[model samples]
Target: MSNRSIGLDGPLYDYLLEHSLREPEILAELRAETANLPEANMQIAPEQGQFMALLARLMGARRYLEIGTFTGYSALAIALALPEDGTVVTLDKSAQWTTTARRYWERAGVSGRIRLELGEAGNTLQALEAEGETSRFDLAFIDADKTGYPDYFEHCLRLVRAGGLILVDNTLWHGSVADPDDTREDTRAIRAFNDALHHDERIDLSLAPIGDGLTLARRR
Candidate 1:
């Protein structure tokens, strides 16, 4: 058996999902509906949602922060894993998409636990920081604009308490990160962000090969 993570081919991927995935009915419905959208790829994979939910439970996460809330699948997963008192504050620029997210959140009966803030995320994050919100969150997830990752990560670090967790999505960028010839703007940004996280001294980092790629950073 290999010591490292194995590459998942079509059959292997299917096997993994069959054996490991445990998606909720509502989440599954959300996934199916999102699949028909033009920007459906922005949705996190079901397995990734499960994994993040596990992370939330393991960390005893209560106050959650999400930088991107496209259709709210990830937020819902995290919310389901949390206690009734736990809450998630999610930010997104699209009222249209988040409106759909709110509908599902309400259906899941976790609407009261999720606070959606609409508008430019960067400015919103700055406002949070300006309001003395440093070290206020237990966990922060970043899955928004690729170009804004660095800024998002910085704000997330500031918002999370010492020893809190920060989860960054799309770190692999569909494997374009490792290809020297693939210098797309988003690719370059992800690559640069990955490198910075790799060298950052304030956090413990792991680049897990889940859904495109997920980077976990625990504040030190």
Candidate 2:
């Protein structure tokens, strides 16, 4: 067996999806519609969504928080995995994109379980904290602006309960975090975020090489 994660070529990646991915029809439809958008890259991969849903199911997650709701694909994934009493509070600033997301969430019959909050995510997070929401969620997913990751993470640390999971998307930043010369704004932000989390003792961490990159942080 390989000691490191195996590189996935086009053929291999296709094979992996064909053999393992279980993207539901509604999610597939949502993915298809999102693929036409200019910011389609913002959407998480199907496999990544499935993987996250599995995590929620395994954790028996009931209260989930999402910082970004791009087309609501990831939120829908987790919503499906949660029980009838489960709820998802997803935040986003884009009305147009989230409109598409809402339609699909309705089609999937999980709209009632998901509450969409529209506004600046940081401000909303602060409001949640002010509303006595400390350590209240079972899981939190951050996938919004790269620069806002640090602030969002801090909010999640408090919003997510002890021993809960906080998942950060695009932590590897399309592999740019490894390039010493790529000093771009978002790249730098992601790098700094990763570095801080590396030495952070409050949570157990692992950066999985899936999609852009999925960072799993389990609060201690």
Candidate 3:
């Protein structure tokens, strides 16, 4: 056996879910619904959602933030884990996708806890900063456009409290980041972001080999 994380084959993945996944019925239903969408691949894996939810609970997160809310699955995952008084502000440009997300959120009865900000995420973030919202969030998740990741992370660093956590999705870009020959713009952007994060002293970082690769950066 190698001294590293074990790669999950189909059977092993099924077993992992069978033994550990505690996905709620509502979440399962949402996943099923999102599966039929044209951008279904944009949805985060259920297991990844569960992991983020647990992490939120462990950190006692309250004021959560999200950069890209694809169909609201990830946001729902975090919102569901929050206490009644907790809130999540999710930003996305597409009214269509967010409308779908809103439906699921309403159905889950967690709609009241999530605020949707539909606009250019970068500008929205700047507005928040201009309003003197510094270190205001407990956790911020980034799953937006790959090119915007660096900017999103910078804003998240300001919005998240000292010692707060920032979760970046698709850091691996579906394994493209590790492929030297993948010269695609998105791949390059992800690689650049990862490299910068690796050397950044303002946060403590760890790249997890979960759904599409998740990077955890805790502000210092």
Candidate 4:
């Protein structure tokens, strides 16, 4: 796939991170600590975190849901930006990884605002559905397993209220979505998700060329 998006490369990426992203010291430390982790790629960029925070504020979101916690960076970002009464339910099955996430959440003093649910994402989502959680979330972020994106989207759509926002990460699949030669399962799944989203009439969608591609779907 062609990397048509104007992303900062090597030196430029570092330069932007240093000069533009004024990340807090604690957040920076957390990012550094997880830099070598197997799922380090799951951490959202500082710019992306800032954007999500802004969206949360702009939407006046009080009840949020996140499909993946990943060391709690994004959850922390959103919590910090939300109102005092706001709450976030973050899902991830890894207790090992979430140990780090919980540490940071407590350190940030946002532990009360976040609930860490450890289990298969689909099962947790299904449970939420069974609990009659439809239209209860003001905002939802999906960035978990790629193969399950479609399921996540469907559930999140039901969970988020009308006019709420659902943000899907990695829609571009590192440029693989546009590559005809790429037949990997993750890439194919992402392609199918994108195609379905393009025609889906339930939401107003825009596939932004943000970090790894982010799709914003505002429920109608």
- List the lowest-lDDT window of 10 residues for candidate 1: 127-136
Estimated TM-score per prediction?
Answer: 0.98, 0.99, 0.97, 0.93
lDDT of candidates 1 onward, in order: 0.95, 0.95, 0.94, 0.90
| lDDT digits (tens) for residues 128-196 of candidate 2 | 999998999999999999999999999999999999999999998878999999999999999999999
Question: Residue 154 deviation, candidate 2, in Å?
Answer: 0.5
What's the C-alpha lDDT at position 203 in model 2?
99
lDDT of 1: 0.95
Clashing pairs in 3: none
lDDT per residue, candidate 1, 76-143, as tens digits? 99999999999899999999999889999999999999999998999999998998888989999999
Question: lDDT per residue, candidate 3, 107-211, as tens digits?
Answer: 999999999999999999999899887899999999999999999999999999998999999998888888999999999999999999999999999999998
- lDDT of prediction 2: 0.95
**Models, CA RMSD each:** 0.8, 0.7, 1.0, 2.8
Decide which is better by lDDT, 2 or 4: 2
Question: Of 1 and 2, which scores higher on lDDT?
Answer: 2
